[model samples]
Target: MGFAERFPRWTSAVLAIIQLALTAVIIGLEIKSIFIDLAHGTIWVGFWASLIFIKTLVMMLFITCCCRGRCCATYVLAWNIFSGILACVTIYFDRTFINDPCKCYLGDKLCCAVRSVDSFRTNYTSILDQCGQAIANNDKTALQWCSTGSPPYDKVQYLKAQLGCAVGMLISCALYVVIYIFACLGICFGHD
Candidate 1:
């Protein structure tokens, strides 16, 4: 009897839980990026939106596998391998996507800057209002102030989020491949 033959039943269940968690996190990050992209009128809205959908679908499949237990090991392994590959591709695309607040309307500049301020995470509306007044008054320094703020703009935060998700997804992908290999061995050796 080898590792697969002695593979405990709880491992699969634990993996399912982990898969659920990774999928959920990825979905949340993608949705957040999508919102920011939409507000900034980014050309990549469709791509990010699709990522949310894909993560949601992957979560659903993970739940199904969890409910079915070890009996569906082969199928689960296949699904995870595919999902892992998809996540890798998603990460690559996310890392390559351009993030720039200047691309949005001028009115959005202040909001973008305020949103990037980690301390003012919730007071974005007020900051935007104040910035809007300056813009309306034709304040020449307003653009300079907003653009050169300590936090810069929301694009920076959005890029951080994308990078975080991509790193997490990449780890999940490696874990999935490892689990899939174990499952393959277990099945081939007729381990229960």
Candidate 2:
């Protein structure tokens, strides 16, 4: 069957086009984050490497959006929004995690800390449990128990900064998913 026959009408195809455009935008933003070739001086965020984990997933969802299904496109859109928010949150957390003076640098800007793969690995490993405990309660107290330097602002503020991007991604993804399904059921399936 032709593409239109599978879904009827050209609306699915049209939606697919819009989704594709959005996917392109997301990918472009991701790339821009990584490389700024201009001599204008790239302001590198100290802990950017940690953001790779979230961005990789986003890239996958970007690829998925190139599909032919209207439903699939919608799924991808939803996925993209969710993943984007998630990515942002994860990246934010990563940045904060990296910037933590006690945990990360261990020295002045000019000063070097234990500078080795093994040392880095150990640092991250130590904090894994802390992150988990924080997640268990979704509250800052649990996070503080894990440890952040200074006082009042340390735990909750830091956690909020980290989780905020993640929460944003979650909200966007959820809305996109719901919209796609609703559109498919109502418009594509003829219920609407």
State which candidate has the highest TM-score. Answer: 1
lDDT of each: 0.52, 0.40
Q: By summed lDDT, which 10 consecutive residues of candidate 2 come out lowest?
A: 37-46
Residue lDDT tens for model 1, 109-131: 54344343333567767667667
lDDT of 1: 0.52
lDDT of 2 by residue, 83-120 (tens): 55545655564445435423332222111222223435
Instruction: Indicate the worst ten consecutive residues by lDDT in candidate 1.
Output: 37-46
Q: Candidate 2 lDDT (Cα, whole model)? A: 0.40
Give the poorly placed runs of model 2, Cα more than 4 Å off: 1-158
Candidate 1 error regions (>4 Å): 1-7, 39-71, 98-152, 186-192
